[model samples]
Target: MDTRNITYFIAVFEHLHFTRAAELLGISQPTLSQQIRLLEAEVGMPLFDRIGKKVVATEAGRLLHQYGMKMLQAEMDAKNAIKELRSENRGTIRLAVLPSDLDFQLVPLFVDFKTRYPETSLQAFSTIFVREEVLAHKVDLGIGLSGSLDKRLVQVPLGSEPYELFVHSASELAKRQAITLEELTQHALVMYPKGYLGRDLVDNVCREQGFELNTVMEVGSASSLLQLVEAGIGATIQPKELLKQHPEWSHIVSIPIADPAPIRHLELTYYADRFISKAQQQLSESLIEFFKSRGVGEDLELRG
Candidate 1:
């Protein structure tokens, strides 16, 4: 019943002598005898046979020894697991990110983070989640286009994503290096599905420039939109960084918008109340340093 008594009993069982067991356990011989007696009374079984100057373990004592070994092992294992968890050597970090983040912003950082902490597990879910969901602790953190967020949510601006109209090289619209929103609307616009965050950003910019979207097809994902654009189905507007790595897309003309130079804020958002784990904290530091080295943090603004 009592672990202290069981420990003493195990020591005595192994040594087969109270005096020697007490010496091994750093306890008095009389105290070891009293603890063994208490263990026997609690289990309602005499665990030892005394024959004059010698003591031998009974059936009950042997059984308890087997179970007591298991209990002690389990406790030791639990302690080791907790230590590893606190040290960020083992644990799961839940992350929710926008689909676009996989291309330029999050992919490199994720690769670096994994390399730095190979033991910490990452559970990633790509979604069109807003800051409110992050604030609610629905996910540990999120990476997406930044905007005005709830006061409860804290956003760390990673950088700015520049907007450009992507069109086929041979298309009449691609003749110019950069074109206006007015010029882009003249052609059929293939874009994200309505209510999507990226589409919302494009729509907001269009509205600010005082025009309505003339869309040809609505796509569910960025990859699908790029594919359609590549096939010359229709031209679409998207972040410039998304096309940076692909030289094939270079043939596709990208005309930066004039005047306001439409740009979206990219950020790493998490709940203010949430206590960031060691892994998350390390990740946040790595991200900030990466962004700063690239000159992204020079103009970062924290959104509430």
Candidate 2:
């Protein structure tokens, strides 16, 4: 069985579309189909079942996919090992981070990283599904909410920050040092939708307190949420660090949430079995140091 065939099979299995997989692999649809047929012949079984336009993996295909990921990971490990022997620090490090963090929070850290490691390429994707991307091996690392029991992932605590009410400085709420979770219902609020991790955290806390937030608007973009707040559309609850990072938002004031403040715990997550290249390790270290300098997760500790 050629590793190349296994690679093609995995791509097709993931997309469940021949043309889509072919496009991703830089090959023609016929060439991809021929490769899959060759792989099926070599394995003595059909890997995918075609039901009309739907492509579903057969039992054999599922089994192959399980081990095929490991085989490819091993190949990557071997290449990384050889590259390490040559002391090469140049490679692409793909990472996924929450959109909220990417926009205003972690810009300085990324800038510093690129300045220090000009030879290495950094690709940062802003997404809400950080853990899913990391688990699927679509990204080398992820920065998002912690608390995963998946043994396949290694999560390092980044820090925890409390959710604060962000409002225009002229708002009455801004005059106070803090506000209770229940008090949020009294004011019109702009927030992320229910399914988003940040919104879910706040919703869960509200449910625990036996009340729901009076959200007047639901916006997906963090920056948009802030703009709405600035426009006096409504107040918003977000991590305290967001306001601290954006000093130019002088009109925006953040007041701490009291009566059981909601805190977002973040972690640096990556696949446990995947080999960590030197470049990846450096970036991870830089992230930890950056958080420490900002006094986030004050009791932070490095954990596997």
Residue 202 lDDT, candidate 2, scale 0-100: 92
The global C-alpha lDDT for each of the candidates, from Candidate 1 onward, is 0.76, 0.90
> Taking the tens digit of each residue's C-alpha lDDT, what string does model 2 give over 1-304?
8789999999999999999999999999999999999999988999999999999999999999989988887888788778878865677899999998999878888889999999888999999899999877789999999875678888888888899999999998889978998988899999999899999999999999899997899999989999999999999999988988888788899998986988999999999988888789999999888888888856765555
Minimum summed lDDT over a 10-residue window in model 1 is located at: 72-81
Candidate 1, residues 123-174, lDDT tens digits: the string is 7777886465565455667776776766767888988767888888878877
Q: Give me the overall lDDT of model 1.
A: 0.76
Q: Which portions of model 1 show Cα errors greater than 4 Å?
A: 1-90, 103-105, 248-250, 293-295, 301-304
**TM-scores of all models?**
0.66, 0.93
lDDT of 2 at 43: 89
